[model samples]
Target chain A: MTSTSSPSRKALSKIACNRLQKELVEWQVSPPAGFKHKVTDNLQRWVVEVVGAPGTLYASETYQLQVDFPEHYPMEAPQVIFLHPAPLHPHIYSNGHICLDILYDSWSPAMTVSSVCISILSMLSSSTVKQRPADNDRYVKNCRNGRSPKETRWWFHDDKV
Target chain B: MAAEEQEVRMEVEAVQAVYGDDCEIIHDFPPHLHVHITPRTADDSSQQFVEAILGILCDAQYPQKPPHVHIVDSKGLDENREKHLITTIENKAKELSSCLMLVALCEEAVELLSDMNHPEGNCPFCLYPLLVEDQSGTFAPFMKLMSCYHCFHSECIIRWWKWLQNEIIDSKQCDSTISTSAGNQREMEQQQQQNCPVCRKLFDAKDIEHILDYAGTNSSQPTDVIVEMDGDERKFLECESENNRRQQFESLLKLQQENSGLIEPRKEIVVVPGMYLPTTVMPTLAAIDAADEQHLDSGSTAPEAVDLNIPSNKATTSKHRDMNTRRKNRNHSSRRQPNVYPNRTQWIKKEAVSSDP
Candidate 1:
């Protein structure tokens, strides 16, 4: 979450590459529930398909998450946002930006792609009402230049879904 | 109840006595107790990897039923190990089902702990085995954060720790909200504390002090073999531990030395900085660098001459490779200040004045 407005995108460090490869293998062995990774030659960016849990309001609905890792990854949180046609949830903006703490300020190096997916799924599952954020339009306007969610100085006020 | 209330209270007291302060009585009637159990490390926490507070609950049935045992709190035990501890204790209770087996159950818990006192699984950071030997048939030393028994391969954790330090500094600089409000030194001191990569527990710099060298600081002047060959630095990386590489280098140096007439080590001394200062480079207990100089200059361990043949361990150390290398270097002697100068001067003078064969 080292957001300096510099659009930080660099190749993964050797350590980061090793960690991601290991994570991919681990994800294959035991992927988190309700998430599937679209494997490609690219190790830097991951496109994960998320299905809302069965018992939740967003159940049976599918959404794609575009996760972009910075050079440092885990040390720096990945840029996680939904693809076009993001799910309808209070915390998720219409422009596919999901406002979650873990994706930003609350990120810890301990978290892996699997854990982040689980958190996102839990966020989607816990949504009682399907609606975009109150200021989705304005936020989307600001981010219309294809800004990463990591660039936002996000204030994570809401915890309960 | 088969056993009287007074008898049950007495039994709980006995359990407390046996475990001393480790046993905590939550309630007296049914003997709901919490007992802290550790492996048989003889109170040496460094040797201990797991500890748990077992929550034991008993019903009004007294000795007619067994107590409910679960792990109330634990450190170093992962989810699987925690479940195993609980399951085994629960089974032990079942076996001692109808009897006053409070103390016996606690002992069983201890026995389980003693059996499972080792750190297992891959390092959280590297996703590599914590206790396994590598392709080189040597084990990469692993250690645990003292505060929380979260274990990691020394190099792996050190690598993460270094990365984290850089990230913190980068983020702090980027965070302009507090720009210049807090002095940089104070801010740095506050941020110097790092979280355990596995548990997120705050650990002191001291927690990793022992394993710092594993990142190849090579602080201590090793008497190990310095490889005579050059430019195959990639081979150095392949060696398991620095120890194995040192041995490999020593044997290679020996092969060259025994064929002393065939290969002159004095002419081809390859000084890998912060690496491979084979004290055994000298045939006798003479100044290692001076001996090399002896062949060329007939033993002049002058600081300049010796400096070329013997790159001080400090010169070769890669502080830049380690982000917080400068901080760790604080414990070391001055980087350029050669500690071997005095010894070399005397040794070189003896050989030089005595005149060569």
Candidate 2:
């Protein structure tokens, strides 16, 4: 059973729209290294392509990340998850639900999509073993009902990649 | 020589007109001038956010050679921003290579300063743009950490500071078995210094506390006063208090009118001399009773006697005392009702339902 949690359908607030526009302009001017923003008309959802940094275990490999911004973005953390063919890493679940702290409790509004992409890529590059989390099967089963990973009560015990 | 001197005077006057008191003439003959430049908004004579003093030195050859430009001093501008400003001015000078460009150079500096007037980049805590370009007046108020100059939305930083304080308190209470030497040292450091959330530089708690004080006084619904309870609990309490406040205000207004013949015709109220209370006492009496009601509603001790004594010094009418006692009794009875939300969701739903119509 593979279920992806449906994102909230609420429209982006005026502040969120304005901020995202600024971020888009900035990304066009100077995007983070090894990342490309897959441009779309929807400001609320962003699909970005990330290339693993050189010399890391996952180097030369590419992954797609989907970020969904809540109506009260910056006040609330964006929901970020991997697309199909999710990265095989200790912190990343098979269902593309990332266990990264910044994606959950440790997220600061000060982070941009560009900064987030950089962090995700860094997480990928530091992987010594390409494998799903130890409890991936159980977690994926629990999320089979298409639960948005934002609802997960994540325990971030690991600081090291 | 006379022609050159006259030209220099005219150039100085032009620079002075543009810069006003900001332009200082160090030398008239060779035309060495110091002009203070600050970024100004389109209108308004208020002080600009950033300012710089530029020293302009002209050689004896005048128009044949471009003047030497150097930054004298600046405030609220970083080294990089200062470099950008100087580089921009230098480029403008190079573009207009050789003519009497003193006033023009001053104008370019003012333009650049005006463009650079606002602080750049994301607020350190929230990662949002420090200055939202599209929204004209809806920008969230932000403050700089006095030590590091890292800026954050006043609300965001205050929330983080409060969270930190709560964590420290919780850790202290639970420190019995968890007291390792290393842990103790870190705890001691945390106690001795509070660091900036973004830069990790030491910042005085007094800075945030000052803003917290202001927030408490300025806003009726301050986040800190809401207390760190679950969402439902907070919402219920807020809604209940809001309803109570409205009721209290309405009652107070009614009392004010009844006592002072404000709404009723003066002829109908029949203000008999000697039997009537002074007009000034009516509002104060109503205010004291309202305050007393609020104190009781919040479950705080009613300081009615202290308030009543101050105002009663002038007009101590027996009828007013009787009314005060009656209102106090009514407040006491209302205060007995427990402020609990048994079915939180149902209460919220009911509130929503009532508000919808």
Candidate 3:
């Protein structure tokens, strides 16, 4: 296995790299409020730290988000997942895969890592309960072979939370 | 009272007479109507970025009471512009006082719109000025998606378009392979309608095809693009700092492997240390969670929370991973703030200037 999970994809295309770098610069100028980008030289991957909004159920809690960008980045959605001990949330699973649509099918090129982070934080902020998804065990087991979350055909629940 | 009713009816008829198809009268009494306004471009939307339909509803007291004018619908205007338009109309209503100001308010909106009728702020793609104002007379060219007036720099949009087309072709190839059931969804999205990068509005191939080869959107920018592309590719892998960071990340991974009892290496999918059968898993998972808390308490080895909760002194082990503003700037392409959006963004600039001390 390639040390990294992005073997199914190619290297960041020239345009994707260019666009991501632009995102990086913009992130520094004004990062999404409740999230901080953990500096990594890996242009294709970003590890950002997120804090729960003050009044949210996950308040004062911190979580790590690992975002892996595909070669066709803006055209394709990034693979975003939480690191284990994933903030116990209904949409986030035990294995760290987040069931967020923008991280998958609904991603738009105009959206940046900052926007996605904001969306994730909002998702956490709106969460009324802190627990794993009902099928956390099954989902984690299915991902035993290290299938990227992008491979899972997620049926996005309505944006209720 | 009959004469006053006649006067109201006459005013309603006058609104119909002037605006014709552009006006929609909701009620004849007291004249509640919606007026569609476009700048003086002879209906050439390609040159137009803003348009609005205004609703004006006058009470039965007629001219003695001012009508309520509000933006029924608008496009290409931000919150500030919308507020500006409403504020101006309210002030205009007060100026007209007891006069029939429906038509006057509509006129003011059209004039105000024309003044703000250019694409403003940043291109959704690169987050840079869609129309840069450089004296070199060689700024990046930009265009709007016809389906929606959302605009982008020619190169930025074209590059995204090319990637989309490539993705479609790639997915088509996957239709015959081990690709998941998403193949059907892929086939459906395979049609000529690609989404607007900004609004997700579907746009046709022709929207981008015209600029596929713009004889180059800018001579200097293209060369800069090529050099940057090569440099970025190299920078991601072979650059000294990048290799160094890769090593650091590797060392962190190795550290995670060594401390696998406390934390899991998410990327590796290695069997979780305390993970076992489900019947007996709960208590152990709880124990692991406690171990996790203790590890977090120990610090450094705790991925990001360690960095956030205890940023400075506690991160001495991975001091390089600290969030320095300069380090953040170095990893990406620096997009400058929108200082001068020469046209449509003038209101934003105006707001900033007024807010400044």
Candidate 4:
């Protein structure tokens, strides 16, 4: 448990504004063709649409991924949740704090907004198991008991799938 | 890690721009790099004016921090090149200012070399005017190569470099202590000399060397070397054998602790079965809790659940703590491993389920 110092309100605001500006600039650039993005500070919501899937479990679904940034912008990682109804995967649970090392313990300042989006896309594309984590109910219980989603420890050692 | 890596890369780029494929930036700089930049101020030369301006920027733009720049050459003290250098520096300063927030502490380095009066006192580490050299003639002249942000003697820097070099050598030797190839094992076997590199203490290296010899030699020596053998030669050999066995055991344990990440420090705990927190694991858990409580006290939002599974029974907890204390007392302490366990509720649930079944 590392000590996380709170960024000053002014610093937080400035950081948020900078990140927001960067995001806006990206949106204005060559937009992801057919996909749309929506952001709202009130809900602390960040949404992005994914287009063109074979309608398998996720086909034709305008999957909306949610991103929530903490006050300490770059210091802490964002909370990424899948808002759209989705099939369960062994790595993902009902509440969507991702199992990725990058989002939690291994986040690097070099990672930008676009890289995060690409990570999620890759996570979705590569998943093969059709279950909501190895121990689904235990994971949810841990979350409700105020444990971090990561503590449940879904071991994804097998990369074959 | 990334930020430090990037800073090194930027420094390399800066060097590359001037040297232009002629030099490679060496990574193994002495811990304290001493730099001295003396502007070539020739009379009425435009370059002198440029140098004056650059010097002013060095002083005013970045006060308190030593300038990371070192004058590579004092040749061609001409006017146009001086103006060009000033313009180059101004542009670089502007670009650096844009990254002021991330590079704040580093930028202070500019002010380090700017001060002329504080020559003898400049910190070789931070290049600050804090550290004054000992008047005793212990400081080396090579220390003037780069102003260390904190003043350190040239010999001190060289000593640090030597220590780092030796450490790398030791680590590499430790890694190759075991060899899969017969040829390499034979080479190591022949290289054995009974002595400790550190402390100049004597140790029985022959026994360890024998293990290296035995490992790939089809186990020619007896499975166990008996201590109470008849001859004095045999007794000495047995002692060496015992020492080698101990060395091998310690090395294996250290290697396991490094790779497993299960040991005392709570690096990342993904619950798994048959995982007893690595040896003497209780203190690391205690440290984690202390860390958490400190975080909360510092006013970061309280974490969702303390979620640490530090055992409750006073006897068992105390016993575990004692084990760690004893390990710390042991001479060869490599790293402290953390005691990580499944959350109490989950443990109870599993126990209940198993009991019912």
Q: TM-score winner among the candidates?
A: 1
* Tens-digit lDDT string for candidate 1 (A12-83): 776678889999999999999888999899898888999889988988989898887777665677878888
- Angstrom error at residue B160, model 4: 26
The candidate 4 chain B region of ten consecutive residues with least summed lDDT is B348-357
Which residue pairs in candidate 1 have backbone atoms (N, alpha carbon, C) closer than 3 angstroms, thus clashing?
B273-B316, B274-B316, B294-B299
Tens digits of per-residue lDDT for model 2, A1-161: 33344456667766567778878998999999999999889898888988888898888889888898876565467888998888889999877889888877677656788888888888888788988899999998877767878888999888788
Please identify model 1 stretches exceeding 4 Å from their true place. A1-8, B1-3, B171-189, B218-357
Instruction: List per-candidate RMSD values in Å.
Output: 15.6, 14.5, 24.5, 24.1
Residue-wise lDDT of candidate 3 within A42-138, one digit each (tens)?
Answer: 9998989988899889888888888888766676778788876688988888778889888878888799888889899889988888788888788
Interface RMSD of 1: 21.5
TM per candidate comes to: 0.71, 0.48, 0.65, 0.29
- Interface RMSD to the true structure, each candidate: 21.5, 9.0, 19.6, 17.2
Model 3 error, position B293 (Å): 65
CAPRI tier for the interface of model 2: incorrect
What is the Cα-based lDDT of residue A159 in candidate 1? 88
* lDDT, residue B284, model 3: 35
Top of the candidates by DockQ = 1
Collision pairs in model 2: A5-A146, A109-B126, A109-B127, A110-B126, A110-B127
User: CA lDDT of B168 in candidate 3?
Assistant: 50
Off by over 4 Å in 3: A1-13, A39-43, B1-5, B59-66, B133-135, B176-190, B213-357
TM-score of 2: 0.48
Error in Å for residue A137 of model 4? 1.4
